[model samples]
Target chain A: MSAALEALQQRLGYRFQQASLLARALTHRSHGADHNERLEFLGDAVLNLTISRLLYDRFSGSDEGDLTRVRAHLVREESLHRVALALRLPEVLKLSEGEARGGGAQRPSILADATEALLGAVYLDGGDAAAHALVKQLFGELIDTTTIDNWRKDAKTELQELLQGKRLPVPSYRIVATHGQAHAQTFDVEAAVPALQLSSMGSGRSRRAAEQEAARQLLDKLRAPPAR
Target chain B: MSAALEALQQRLGYRFQQASLLARALTHRSHGADHNERLEFLGDAVLNLTISRLLYDRFSGSDEGDLTRVRAHLVREESLHRVALALRLPEVLKLSEGEARGGGAQRPSILADATEALLGAVYLDGGDAAAHALVKQLFGELIDTTTIDNWRKDAKTELQELLQGKRLPVPSYRIVATHGQAHAQTFDVEAAVPALQLSSMGSGRSRRAAEQEAARQLLDKLRAPPAR
Candidate 1:
């Protein structure tokens, strides 16, 4: 094995009995037909399950919705890319000449995929314990460091969570209008809770964003005193 | 413990070291603030990982996309609900007086979440081996029985995969029109592959169905000889 690969394994803290698995893990589909796609698939599930387990254990006071959101944030492509960069994945990734020239190694999706493939490789080589340990080592600090308040919750999440805490039925949102040019359209959304007779509207560049804005306003109304 | 609980333990093939864990897993959020939501959150991950590892090892010849599709089919709400029913989940579930009167025990989401909570309880009480064994025992028949041909792939999936196999660009779909009453509108969708200079339109009662039909027609077009 090359010294670089050995160093990569050292960083992972999980040495592979079969070095070929590590090599395959770093290979991109752009490189050849035989590449990391299968490993990436396996690794994606492993990474999600491992992270979900971690979040579930650490946040006893948090509900399932909170746990779900936190897990989604932790395992999303951006976070995986961060972990890949931390492990210097871009240095050893194998790519086709075309992709290499196009900067595929630096791409977020590829880096994140390779990260999952690495986990899958470890699991295949050393079983769950080794893979679990690697996941913990790579992600432990992030898990410990992430405060729920550290990130912005989308307005829909904020609205639903506020209602859930109060054991009230969740508010609903609907797209009320779409306007402007086809290229520069805007979405107008209305969020309402029928039981509370509360409603609000907001508009934005996308349907989802508009819904969030509307939800944010509706949440504020929920917080305010009732009007005569 | 009640005789019914003991019967459940017997069926599970693993007695909980902490009986209270089992009891908590059986409790619904409607029952009280302290409920199975947290355990259900943890168990959902454990179940997904266990099933993923199983599928990964068993299906060596299958591609990642195929593996993903199969896993999704196995883990969807209907599948989980079936598993829960087979385990006699309804007999032992605890709900609030209101929910109980409304037959909440038979609800798919409740049953599925409770099933997951039981997994969490087992994992917590006896650790990974116990959990793995439980999952394997519960799902062994399902793992053995399911074949790729048993479930129908959606038109969009079939089209995308056909293109993927041929190294062609994926098609894009857009809603072209909506007609009829608001209560029962028909959607017209167009699927296009600009790279292939091909396009098709289909109409259906729903947007998704219309898109699928359009994709089906596009696939048919791709299969036909050159029109020029």
Candidate 2:
């Protein structure tokens, strides 16, 4: 365990000033009475603060919605679980005999928790500055490196938020038509603001997809200046 | 505009390789025909990924909820506005005449947007690596610098999300007691989970504040292990 912990420490880029903190971070609730739950709590806050600041500073022009979606994507359960695996966090995680046999280490929720617990350990061992430095080094590379121009666009999230804020009824989407072969299908979607009797049509590979496209078009129309 | 931009550049610790991108980043919609909206979108995604990685690496033991809250607080409207002001962003902002007089330059939304746009500009001016380095340098100092351990306690938001997600009746709060004088009053609150028939109590300085405390207590009860 110590050897694996040492390797994890090397990967984490921070030497724990207090070895006990590191140990606690690795201890899961299933392991015994003592566990990483508290550390998970603290580390969650520390991690969130660091990441929030990074996003805030990096995306100055983005509205709250875009910022939120991107952040959600980055810190989601799946992504965090991937990072945990990349760190080989599961190898050193302490689990009960039952949990270990049940493959708790590979579970997304557990992995995410362990990842957070490690952050708490770093925060406790070295304090906020150390935690911040470590976090920046980890996240900066991925965020700064990736081109995020091509992620899926969700017009529903945008429209729901927009209409809710405006005290307007939420828009609804319906599949108006479908065409072409199954392998090369095309869908015609209609998004309607029922009260306004304004329905816009959009085409895509699936009804849901087409509806989203229609919503985007409708949003543009709604936001456009009124004609003279 | 150049002087102000130069000053901002110096403060953020990056020299834009493509000055045009930087210029576009700073161009607010109100200021001119070309605005920072597009740059804002890209920057938003970049910021989230960067920050997510940072937090993951820094706080190895944190959980999703904890990280989410901390990030939300750090990147919230108010904090970004302060950072924007620190960059003296308002001084060089292009705004429509109406917006200028309405003080849109200093508005929290505008200031936060400009900050993200600046990040996009940095990303474009420099590569992702450069942008990451710049964002990390700028925001690294702000991580977990708050006075209150705000990360541990966002009961109100949590309660709202929980109710919304579970499709349970929204928890309702009522003031159970009040203590102390007007200047230093403390209210005791009871939060009732109607469906669960579970009620918890908490105390705070104001009604809303007390309600949040009660909500926290309620959440704890909900999370408690069931009796065998």
Candidate 3:
């Protein structure tokens, strides 16, 4: 194995029994047919499972929605890219000459993919324990520093806060319809921001749940870039 | 443990060490404060990882895209609902009185969530080996019966087949733009079915990849319900 790979494994804190896996993990599709895409696919799943397990244990009181959001925040391309930079991935990634010239090594998507591919390679090389341990080493600090309270607020509270920050009147929510028998009714709620001329509808088993869903939808719209 | 739960464990081929986990897994939110959503979240990750690993091993020569499509077909809500029904989940699911009267036990979404919750419960109760074994027992047959040829076709071919099946003309593809240096250019392609007044665009590192993406987008539009 090359000195660079030896150093990378040391930094990753997991040595590969099969060195080829590490080499393949660093190879971009532009470089050759034997690249990291498959490993990336497998690694993405591994990363998700590991993170879910971590958050499940860490924030025992947090609900599924909060856990999902926090997981998303942690695994996004930008977050992965930051981790990749910390590991100095640009020095190791193998790209075609042209791609290299085009700065593929520094690309956020490529860096993020390589990170996942590395996890996948570790899993393939040393099994679940190795991969899980690697994930913790790479991500444990981030999780440790995360404040659950930031993500614990329900959708309605977040949406209201966002609108209030912009000096807009609070949105209004109303029950638009109810289906099924009273005991098992599904409520459909509509939330409208008159100042923004935006409206969204959501349905759930209870009025509050439906309103929260509607507010979440509206928040998504408000945060999204304007459509072309 | 209740006889019904004991029978479920027998059918699932894995008994829980902590029976309360099983009870909580069977409980829907409508039933009370303690519910299955959190477990469902964890189980969804377990299921995806297990299925991805299975496909990775089974289709040694298959590309990542093909593996992804096949896994999706295997783990979709409809597929989970089928497995849940086979396990006779409806007979054991805990639902609110109103939910039971409204047939919540047999609802596809509820059954599917319960199925995932059960897997999560198993993972917590018996660790990875037990959970892995349970997933294989439940889904191994489905994976074995799946013919890769159905999912092996590229998006363009699948779109062509769908259009031909409907007796419509084949779609046309054109390169709308190419960005970056020649050696590392990204292609943007547009695919259109003039007869249906439908079109979609996709961008990728190569023309073939871009066209496949465009076809996939068009296919998604064709299969989706009419927009509200």
Best by TM-score: 1
Report, to 2 decimal places, the DockQ of model 2.
Answer: 0.07
Could you give candidate 3's per-residue lDDT for residues A24-111 as a string of tens digits?
Answer: 9999888877889899999999999999999999998877878998998988999899989988899999988878888999999999
Once all C-alphas are superposed, what RMSD does model 3 give against the true structure? 14.7
Off by over 4 Å in 3: A152-154, A157-228, B153-228
DockQ of each: 0.22, 0.07, 0.19
Tens-digit per-residue lDDT, B18-120, candidate 1? 8999999999887876689889888988888888888887887776867888888887888789989988989999888778888899999999999999998
By lDDT, who's the top model here? Answer: 3
lDDT of each: 0.86, 0.74, 0.91
Between candidates 1 and 2, the one scoring higher on lDDT is 1
Task: Tell me the tens digit of each residue's lDDT in model 2 across B1-228.
Answer: 377778877988887767777777777776664678766665654565456546555655565556656667666668778878888888877767767888888888988888877876776567556767866775677763532245765787788788788889888888988999999999999999889889999999999889988998898777653322
Clashing residue pairs in candidate 3 (N, C-alpha, C atoms within 3 angstroms): none
Best by DockQ: 1
Count of backbone collisions in candidate 3 = 0
Give Cα distance to truth, residue A199, candidate 1, Å.
16
- Of candidates 3 and 2, the better by lDDT: 3
